[model samples]
Target: MSLPTVRTVADLRAQVAAWRGQGLRVALVPTMGALHDGHLTLVRRGRALADKVVASVFVNPTQFGPSEDFARYPRDEGGDAAKLASAGCDLLFAPDVSVMYPDGFATSIDVGPVTRRWEGAFRPGHFNGVATVVTKLLLQGLPDVALFGEKDYQQLQTIRRLVRDLDIPVSIEGVPTVREADGLALSSRNAYLTAEQRAVAASLNRVLRDVVERVRAEPGTVADAVAAGERALLAAGFDAVDYLAVVDVASLEPLERLDGPARVVCTARLGKTRLLDNFPV
Candidate 1:
């Protein structure tokens, strides 16, 4: 039998705590309410790792800047619930923003230096919001494990670091990014792309792939390789290139030279939407 979903911090915890009393290991898939295959993969991973699953569908307004597309971010609660139910999600916590931030919910988690790099520097206050909401969800869900896909690899890194630093009790799982047949990383923002832009969105991943390949084959300086990637995006139709840098895979520090276990990370704006993709080198 499928488990029923519950909303709110109190009711949701009551249900999961009851399951835990019966020795059930629970896992969670936290999302912003767009139930794509990438998200389903996280849910499936949660199901495989634990007896019960919780998928939180909150778009998170704080994570969006005033200039960003917060108000226009598509939200389909009925459809999201149906998809989560069909994807074998045991519980869906679709919290109302009012319920989440009711009055003075100002406490936030800050990662200091690590959060200040890349995505953070590009979009101020973004990771602080992510860190806060995720912490809140983890506390509410109290799952034995949590699944986050590799598509948002940097966010994955940030979550992992936060968990370690704060001694959060959940194991963070990093699953592979599910992509389109043409190699575009799956994302809700893909919905914002026009047909013309959709054809080039995959260029994000393609450029990252090329950079990785070049780093491996030609053995150029890391700087040279990342510059080549930025050039690739401009040629492929990105309106603006935000950043394309090679950094240490483990530390995430910018690699000033050819080195070991580096990741080529990029952020670009297509039309009004900002996209990020990375590949291991």
Candidate 2:
């Protein structure tokens, strides 16, 4: 397991191209540092599927809103390096801000339509940054498959659409949402919560599950069920509500009825931490 540092795009491309030329399949696990079991799970899955794994632990500032905690988003390069190395990652592309975004950079990969709802609507330019950075990473890493966690449900779908519509040559694989014992969806933002806030945060995940169960067992319209779930979470001491949507998993369009498979998604603030979670119905 080698932990070679690649500071520029060309440097990384050369290394990846050399390995790929030798008939080795490469995999890329992109992340925003603060490596946890959730992130490690993605790397492990990549290793299982590829001969050489490249994990890019970059925290892109362009993704964060002005008021958002771009400065405070957790990052630990040494720790991340060790984690990736032990997880059998061959290369770690942890570049600096200037390295990834030099001066006079005007390009953006905005996947419209599907990117205009849910998380995208709430966080403007967030998905644009995601799409742009991901396109660059895919072009730079050129892995056969890129594994993404299902916790960012809308995001996973967006990536799939972007890859398909744009004719990117990489495959998109989704990992299921990792959860806490009490069923809190694992998130990097979870580290921002206070002890009490964390307890109250469990309401979001529970509400989604409740919506699915209630919809299936009790049978109701989407609005009726979404309202019920919202009330329960609001009563549980959440600070502010974002949205609670039941959507088609394939297209991410809001659903009117729970006739078949759907995703119950929610996002809200428990103090400063913005938590997002979804469950399949």
Candidate 3:
């Protein structure tokens, strides 16, 4: 069945109310379109967890940095709707900037600390935009649960913190990363890679994997392992390495040694595309 689409908040709430009237549980999966297996995996998880699933497809302008690819960000609403429906999503909340922001929309949520490093350190205001829109989606849908992909690990944590701090009354679920056969994490931005760049894209995961193994083998060598991973990316044809960190999983603070749960996360540039990936350490 074709998925029903709603662009306005009123229409979205009406549909959700109908679902609630039936006493059915609802889950939400928010996205910026250019849907991939990574996005569909979230929808499938939502379906398994709840009776109805709503996926939002808005390419949030506030989330993109001034230098980042806001205009160039990939979008395919028709294709995304098809994929979401096939994955058992019941509705699509695809809103334009005006609908989401409206006129004189001045408020935004500031999710501090957890958003202050890594992706946050590099992309200013990125997580604030993420937190704001996520807050809106959860409030608007008022779903029993909301699903997010762990490919953006920091993002997942940020949303979790936001929900808890605000008492948003929705459960947040994180689905694992989906990857290509070459070990490259599936991302909408992967479309920007040429054949050669695509080949090199696999190195992001490889370097992180090596770091994880090194950290496990020699726990005191976190700095050395991270530095080596950065060097490995440069030697593997990446244009730049932003960061390769072994950070505490909950706090997102840089770890000198892995005494507790931590993750090896990295971001590197391949041509114009910046890739992010992480592995448990």
Candidate 4:
């Protein structure tokens, strides 16, 4: 059966209000559609956390740069709804851009420092889009808990900080990243990869894992390990290495050595698709 979907905030609130009246807890999973196992995993986690699960499918134009693939970003609401139903999602808040931003929407949320490096630096104004929309979603649904995938570790941390800083009432939880058997972190954008590029993309995880192993063996050689990881990506057929470094997991600051909890995060481009993957050390 197809899941119930709400487009406007009024309808969404009405439905959620009905759920609340029944004393049922709600969990939310936000996505840009083009459903995959990774996204479904989040929905499933929501099922486990709350009595009702709401998944939002909005491409979020603000998060995309002028040169970014906003125009071509994959979206399939019918397909996404079917998948969500199978995954046990209770509601689908698939709002259109107008419904979300309206004609006079002017605000953008900017979570400081956390939005200053890595994905933030490479894609300026990206997290502002994320912060704004996610805040709107959380407020709109007022869910008891919100679930996010840890595949985008930096994003998960950024959201966590924003919720804490803004004093949002919902609990923010992160589900572990789901990966392909070959180790490629699944992403909606992975649909853009050509067959040859797909094969090369799997190496991203393998390389990050290797970097983590090397750093674990010799913490002082962090710089050398990351540099070699970038070189390895380039030699493995990736066109460009955007940024590859070890960052403190919580603060996301670049770490000189792995004296504390750290993550080896990287972003490399194969043709036009930018692949992101991280490993812990």
Candidate 5:
């Protein structure tokens, strides 16, 4: 069965308002809509946490760079709505670009420092687009809780910061990064990889896991572990290694030594696809 979809803010709010009027809690799972197992996991989680689940499927042009894959990003509303229905999602808000950003739309939200490194550094103005669109989604749906996959760890953190700083009045929940049996983190962009490239992709997570293990076994070797991890990725057939660092999990600042909680975060390019994965240290 196809899930009910709404395109305009008016219809979205009216439906949500009806649910809220009955004292039902709503949860929003925002996605770019190439619907996969990882995305379905989020929808299931939203259903578990609230009386109704809303999954938004907007490609969010603002988040894509001029040279990025915005034009070619996979989109299938009919297929996605079917998948959402199977996952127990109550509504699908698949808005058109014009509906999301009207003629006079001219504001952007910057979450600052949390978005300064890694994905942000590589794809400039990316987080500004993310923060803005997310803020809009949270406000438009006015969900009691918003669920995001930790697969985009930095993006998750950026959203949390924006909600707290802006006082958005919604609980932000981070779901764990869902991965394949071999450990490759699930991503919409994974569709870009060839069979050979797909096989090589799982090594990215293995390298990060090894780095985290090394850090735990020898806290002083954080820098050494990071450098070694980068070399391992290149040797494992990755075209380039963007960064591999031990960062304070909360603040995302590079850590010289492991004093408190930390994470090993990395981004590497395999052919044309960039793979991101992080492990707790």
Candidate 6:
């Protein structure tokens, strides 16, 4: 059976209100369509936490830069709705660009510091788009909990901070990064990889894992280890390394030495597809 979809804010709120009347707690899993196992895991997490799970499939335009793949971002709402139904999602909110941002839409949520490095550095105004949409989603559904994937660690942190600082009455849960058996973090963009590129993509997780082990074995050589990790990505057929540094898991500040809890994060490109992954240290 296909999941019910709401196209407008009014319909979505009505559905949410009906759910709330029955004392059902709502959990939200927002996405840019192109459903994958990683996304389904989030919906399952939502189901585990709340009585009703709502998944939004909007390829947010503002989040994508001019050169980014907003036009090419894979989308299949019929297939996605079917997948969400099987994953136990209660409703699918697939709003169009106009429905989300009308002719006179002029508001944006600005988050500080957390949006300063990694993805924020490379993709300007990305977090602003994220923060605004997330705020809208939280308000639109007033969900009891919101689920986000740890694969986008920085994004997860940013949302956590956004809700806390704004005093949003919703719990933000970070589901662990779901990976393939060989350790390649599943991503919608993974569909862009060619047969050879797909083979090379698994090495991304391997390099990060090696860096984590190296940091554990000898924290003093973190800088050298990061440099070597970059080299390994290039050697493994990645075209370029954006940033490969160990940083505090909380503050996201660069850690010259791993004296405390940290994460090894990186973004590398193969052709036009950029893959981001991180591991705890």
lDDT of 1 by residue, 2-60 (tens): 44667789999998999999999999999998678999889888889999989999999
TM-score of 4: 0.98
TM-score per candidate, chains pooled: 0.96, 0.96, 0.98, 0.98, 0.99, 0.98
TM-score of 3: 0.98
* Candidate 5 structure, TM-score to reference: 0.99
Cα lDDT over the full model 2: 0.87
Candidate 6 per-residue lDDT, tens place, 42-134, comes to: 999999999999999999999989999999999899999999999999999988889889899999988899889999999999999999999
Per-residue lDDT of 237 in model 4 = 89
lDDT of 2 by residue, 1-281 (tens): 44888878888899889988999998899999998778888888998888888889899998888999999998889998998898888889988888779899989988888888888888999999999999988987889999899989888988999999889999888998878888898888898988999889877888888899877775557888999888888899988779988888877888888777788888987877789999998
The 0-to-1 C-alpha lDDT of every candidate, in the order given, reads 0.86, 0.87, 0.93, 0.93, 0.93, 0.93
Q: By summed lDDT, which 10 consecutive residues of candidate 6 come out lowest?
A: 249-258
* Model 3 Cα lDDT, one tens digit per residue, 141-218: 899999999899999999999999999999999998999987999999999999999999998898899999999999
Clashing pairs in 1: none
Give one digit per residue, the lDDT tens place, for model 5 in 54-104: 999999999999999999999888899999999999999988899999999
Off by over 4 Å in 6: none
lDDT of 6: 0.93
Model 5: how far is 189 from its true place, Å?
A: 0.6
Off by over 4 Å in 4: none
User: Model 5, stretches more than 4 Å misplaced?
Assistant: none
